[model samples]
Target: MILQLIQVSKSFGDHQVLDDIDFELKEPQIIGLVAPNGYGKTTLFNIISNLEKPDHGEIMIFSEKNTNEKIFEHLAYLQDNRVLYDNLTAREHLAFVAACHNVEQQEIIEICDRLGMSHYLDKRVKKYSLGMKQHLLLAIALISQPQLLLLDEPLNGLDPSSVKLFREIMTELFNKGVSIIISSHNLYEIEKLTSNILFLHDQKLIRNTEIDVPVDYFYFLSDIRKIETELTKNGFFWQSKNSVEFLFTLNECQKEKLEEICQSNDVLIYDCIQKISKTEAAYFSLFT
Candidate 1:
């Protein structure tokens, strides 16, 4: 394990936030930290990064045990707010990070270019868009060359185009053997990028399970009564194609239900077989 937490806990004055939370990170994989809002995802990241220490339990890293806290040695954390020096230009921000880790300026520029933020290199961070700000924060994390990367809502405020670009960049980094733990409200993006899940619920870890499916599952919806009526006649079960559509297989006798209903109701079938979006599945699964 690249990172491990043995019975971690934290609190804000009297209220309990994270209680008995035990989690770990294995190298060469991406881990999605998911839960509803206020479940302590950000707090966990803060503890691991040493910005906030846990009230209880031990946090252990594999390679550098018993090391000093001044240098995290193998952990890099990115806060949700894109916490950068607001007055500093992007280039200055990049240069400061590179100097901290002794990474060459040339390499830093290459990373900026890869993230599509090269043009904003000379502009102050306060002037950057939310997406551009995220890009810059991610670049700083990359400079450390960490064994464990902790990201809190890294995709929080990105546009579709930037989200796409961010996914690709993170994928490349994961391929290069960086153990990543990212917290996001965007489960669609999370679904595409992760194999294992660390589900946090009610301020503690409720489940930690590896995904069994191919990350591609069918999502659809038909009227429950209508689908049931059709399925009952045709002898099929409800099969959702995606968010907007559903498909049900029926026996020959039941085949007429869908057709009859559609004709009688005059409701056009918008879709029957669409891709199941990650958010839809995650939302459904959270309840189950």
Candidate 2:
């Protein structure tokens, strides 16, 4: 098994962040840790990385109990850019991590090149942009060649091209048998990366094997009541944004049926926008 948590709970003062939670990962696969801000996603990652001790629970990684610092050599946690030193160049930062992991200089250079960081590697991190900093952090995490990787909001501030590159690297790592738990608010990108999700809701962990596949359509309609009635009669799941706006999930056949219903009833759909992806649909269903 890659990871296991038993009856883990955490709180600060009167605010209970994480309730008793149990989770397990049996194999190498990307799992998205999803939750609202300040809901213990980072806290869970911290506990797993041994940066913070759990209030009550046992955590196991790679079939052994989490205790020895040496066990973490096979694990990597990519935290926020605050961990980076502004005075040091990207090369200096990477060199520090490489030295700790006993990584060779040639390998460090190759990793920097692979991440497209060789161009500005020698520049001090104080001059780096948010995207550049994210790339540097990822390179630092990858330098250790960890079997298990924990990424906390790694996609933040990345451009489209950079995001694509990150996805490609994650795929490459996953194929190499590396287990990853990445926390990101970008539901669309999360869906693209993995179907498995570990959602934190109500201070507990909810595991989902697959994200919902249905597509959601947001419709601005002229006759809200009529459309609502039709939607209910047609067994379509929907939510009202307002009196005139409604969101519905429909398959191709159901979409055609909806169109026919609107045509027959003269219920004008002023504007229809397809907006939600699988992960987004799941997120809304869970949180909203």
Per-residue accuracy of model 1 over 48-166 as CA lDDT, tens digit each: 77678888887777644323564366778888644788899988987887888788978887888888887888998888788888888888888778877888898877888888887
Q: Point out the worst 10-residue segment of candidate 1 by lDDT.
A: 210-219
User: TM-score of each candidate?
Assistant: 0.74, 0.79
Q: Which ten residues in a row have the lowest lDDT in candidate 2?
A: 206-215
Best by lDDT: 2
For model 2, what is the error of residue 129's alpha carbon versus the real structure, in angstroms, after optimal superposition?
0.6
Local distance difference test, each candidate = 0.70, 0.87
Candidate 1 C-alpha RMSD relative to the actual structure: 7.9
lDDT (Cα, tens digit) per residue for candidate 2, span 84-135:
9999999999988999989999999999888899999999999999999999
Where model 1 places Cα greater than 4 Å from the true spot, the runs are 63-67, 208-288
